[model samples]
Target: MKKIELGELLGQMTVSEKVGQLLQLAPMFYKGTITEGEITGPMAEMGITTEVSENAGSVLGSTTASEMIAIQEAYLKTNRLGIPLIFMADVVHGYKTIFPIPLAIGATWDVELAEKMAAISAKEATAAGLQVTFSPMVDLVRDPRWGRVMESTGEDPHLNSAMAASFVRGYQGNPDELAENHEKMAACVKHFAAYGAAEAGREYNTVDMSMRELYQNYLPAYTAALEAGSKLVMTAFNVVDGVPATGNEWLMRDVLRDELGFDGVLISDWGAVKEIINHGTAANSVEAADVALRAGVDIEMMTTCYLENLERLIADGALPVGLLDEAVMRILELKRDVGLFEDPYRGLKGDVDRQQDILSVEHREVAREIAADAMVLLKNDGDLLPLGATGRKMALVGPLATTQDVLGAWSWLGDMKDAVSIEDGMKAQFDQVDVAGAMDTENVTEAEIAEMVRVAQDADVIVLALGESANRSGEANSIATIRLPETQYPMIDAIRALGKPVVTVLFNGRPLDLHGLIEASDALVEAWFPGTEAGNAVADILSGRVNPNGKLPMSFPYTTGQIPVYYNHLRTGRPADAADAQEHYVSQYIDIPNQPLFDFGFGLSYTTFAYSNLELSSDTITKMDTLTISVTVKNTGTIAGKEIVALYVQDIVGKVSRPCKELKRFTKIDLAPGEAVVVTFNLTEEDLRYYKPNLDFTSDPGDFNVFIGTHLQAAFCLA
Candidate 1:
């Protein structure tokens, strides 16, 4: 388990064995459950022999602790060095007791809750015998059309960086004691370096950006995760500077390893190593293997390039034998660090009872609580929410009214049948509740509309649950338009014609262009695919048992044409002023305003909050001084609520162009009616620092504007 022992084990491994250690295959190869024909078909296609599978270093995904235990036991008996196989899976949000998606978690703006949820995910994943989770995806995105935007925290580097560090802390626990902490697993911060900036918001599209933009906006969250002691890093599928990330030596070695100082195991996304050939960076698998290894990819996932060509390349003297040795040593070091050498079956020992730990009642309670806080009240006109003891007849309609598909993408271990339905939650609260559910989003019939109208005509209020299906978002599922499906518009129109108070609950993954839906509904709630206790959480918010406190992490665009709308944008020379719209010689859209429908950090609570008496400790301060900014925030409405106060700073001048505003810090506070508290934040010179044109991160001394909650502004000078 020590360094000397790891070296001795590596020294005993043959060339084929060393190559096999750098190859990660699926569990089916080691399970031996398939027929010879089935095995040979895939093996021949991948150009890997059964022996490669026998000595493979890691398993992609094993379903249960028993399966992992069996696989590791079988693999060690045959492996000459007896190195254990590490189990890894995309345990993104939750394992079995599903929580809200990462985007919804971001809306909560509660990093503590995010960390707690991640710890619960680790608890469940470790019960299933996974040692590594490819999660805490920290890619910052401004485009909502990209399906993977749901995986990232948001567009801001600060929020994403904080969330990334919290996830690493929750998953890895203490870096030094990670091997003994069986409840936790090593976190793998993934899709390294600007994957969210994919061109056209398309999956796997090319990413082209300036080095200044890369260092300033995209790379901070990854660096934050590594600083928090993440044990692994996964390469992005897209190219950086015209080279695939898996094969870009400058990117992986120079930036990620040298600059960021990440000396952990670097693995490629599934089949990304072999796909380097398709990127035109390599001619064949042999070249692909050589290129990826040179780029410092420690493991090639689900690909035969490393297994098939590494040994030959080393023998031909085209590649250094030390490259292979370096990779194998890192893999072994990880194996030892995770206690695989000492225990072999870390959390998968005998008497494994998955049911006791998988989805307990306590886990579901935490899921419900988090889901409730993540629900954003986008619109609450006329105070229609908190339906309370009104004794009003309620009707639940639309496609998602009674469905259990609330668990969003990447919930591989969660079953839809286990999800709570809106109808179930509503019926538990109301004495009289009717339901006319439409299951199809793209195909709604006149008969179905009539059925919905007939059911809701007698009801005093309609709770319309409408959204894109679970498959419409997440990896490989990008849409052209960021609006509701056209078919659902007919139902919305029908429900509006009934002349009843309508409350629409959206179960989407991304920020939608809510043009028609907003007009048709009196109240709107962005539920965002609440998991497990989805219906119960929505009912809690609607019934006044819980208050809506979530805020938007990404901006909701005005239309699909405004694809990359975000709050933090550069101040151009001729910026269009809203006060002088007639002065149109500047950068303004002819048909639409440049602003989004909803800005970042926008959300409504059941109660109102008033900000007053903005104060700065000093009007001017030197670079070494920390300026204290404070504002008194009061709960003006007649109920207790939680408010997320944000702090933004603008650098007046810099060596390079800067955004008009950038979020530096934010905090959530709970206040009761008539209770006011002074929220304080200290801004230092380091907080104003940014990437210069020459890639130096430092601040410029100049005049600056500071904003708290978007309205309270104060000016200060750094002399």
Candidate 2:
């Protein structure tokens, strides 16, 4: 269909039909789907009608191709224009063949691998008949206390931007090609404008920050995702400045649409429009609907505010009909773009072969590969890892040893029974493997600890699978203290007392306070949530089948006291010296050291790497000249491994205080034993640009120090 046809369709829609096009509800509200049921209480409460339900532009949460087909097929019978309903869901990480969580994908530091994982997720999700995924949540998170940090890539804007673009490309292919492509689904970059910086790291708390800070830190990744051609943006539940994002005109219109040039669908985050009343921004549902529509929100999700009040608002001359026409046109264009106007089901007509498409062998292999690459080796004391499978009797003991809740949150379509446990993967690799532990982390008993110790006594090495359960992190799951449950400490202490070398594998979603666990374990693996291939990936790393190459995307704090520890932070006047702890009047904690337990970009390999011969092409350069940096990395240990070389820049002088070190570029390279290779990076003037105090984004001409992997430094001047 042509653009003029969309205009014609918009012109044909009545006031009620246009309002219905701006509303998105759940599939259960409609009939003929798998979850066809009555919600009389909710229906009466939200004032929903059969007419509005049949004419809703989209559905939020429905699984399976048959459900989508049934919903669309049944709905078209009632509508005069026969518009198709688009199905969207929170397919955050994966659909059926689950990969590692978004945070784990960031730890891989491989943008290509991240893109591959997302492509596989799109393949699986589209096979199940999903049309849009609320994914690649590009929120820059510095606080691990925020449970939604698992949804974000990390603290750095640059890394998150790179991952965001990669995810968009994987999900939608090219924006121009998304219209005709049936294998991929549309991508929605969510929680727009600093939802991650909620005060106190609490979920849905107030997000108060200066506009300059917002632009400098929180807004870049969202801009990058939009630039990469994401088709939709989700409004955040929190407030931007003093106004809720769902009803903030300056944020939605002046910033997102006008400045960022995003003209796509803007949907509210699960009744965020109605909740604006709770934020004291609106007096009632009527006011909320009027405000949200004027603020440029295209869809009111999970609420009937638009269905209930949009027509009245327009009749009272409060809202122009042109706004409704514009919104309806966008929805129609999206429908036409996704080929829904032509084929409402979008190739989901026939019975989908689950075995051949959903969790096929190819998909599982990609999941396993990504899961292994995403596991970061946080610690390895005296080379205790890579246990020899032939001679050693390995005992897998912990709450997560045999449980299949390895696929973490937002995996709506993933079944726990299909997930591989640590015990299952270990037994496949080793003939002598024993497992004994509690099945639940919070419900562990003394008897379970005693049994775990008994199993550890007979084994040469212990592979302790521990960490937060699948529910401990994700949206609305924030905790005050980012520590392991107290109940599990006894299990850790008991196994450590056995004097067996313990290689601890953590299945968590956020950075944790690892003070006690670090002391009790010989080796530590930060396996965030490896999805369906959890056990096999852990086994590969433990048995020397795959080397651990993942790095820390977020810093591990010493304790919860240091809640928001990150590498790139503004310089202070009086900096604390780690050499002198007694010094006062500095930014240092009295009880604990200021440094993080494990810094960002910190990871280990079974084989070690040595950096040498740092050189720069020139000491000075103009704005137009590109500076070349070179460093040689050697695999010092006697094994093949991948090394991540990180490059950071420190601006000596700027208009405002700048971060002491900021990551500019990084690369992952494979090296064999005793092999060396020169890694080079071209640094242009664009790399040094930052927002000034007056909000002007430009690079400064000053002295800069380039550090390679936190050690080798070379001084240069940007002239």
Residue 119 lDDT (model 1): 90
After superposition, candidate 1 runs with Cα above 4 Å error: 32-38, 350-354, 578-582
lDDT, model 1: 0.90
Compute the lDDT for candidate 2: 0.89
Error of 2 at 697 (Å): 0.8
**Which ranges in model 2 have alpha carbons more than 4 Å from their true place?**
34-41, 350-355, 578-582
For candidate 1, lDDT tens digit of each residue in 180-292?
A: 97888999998987999999999999999988888988999999999999999999999999999999999999999999999889999999998999999899999999999
Per-residue lDDT of candidate 2, residues 136-219 (tens digit): 799999999999899888999889999999999999998777667778889999988799999999999999888888998899
Highest lDDT model number: 1
Task: At residue 615, give the lDDT of candidate 1.
Answer: 98
Please report, in order, the local distance difference test score of every candidate based on alpha carbons.
Answer: 0.90, 0.89
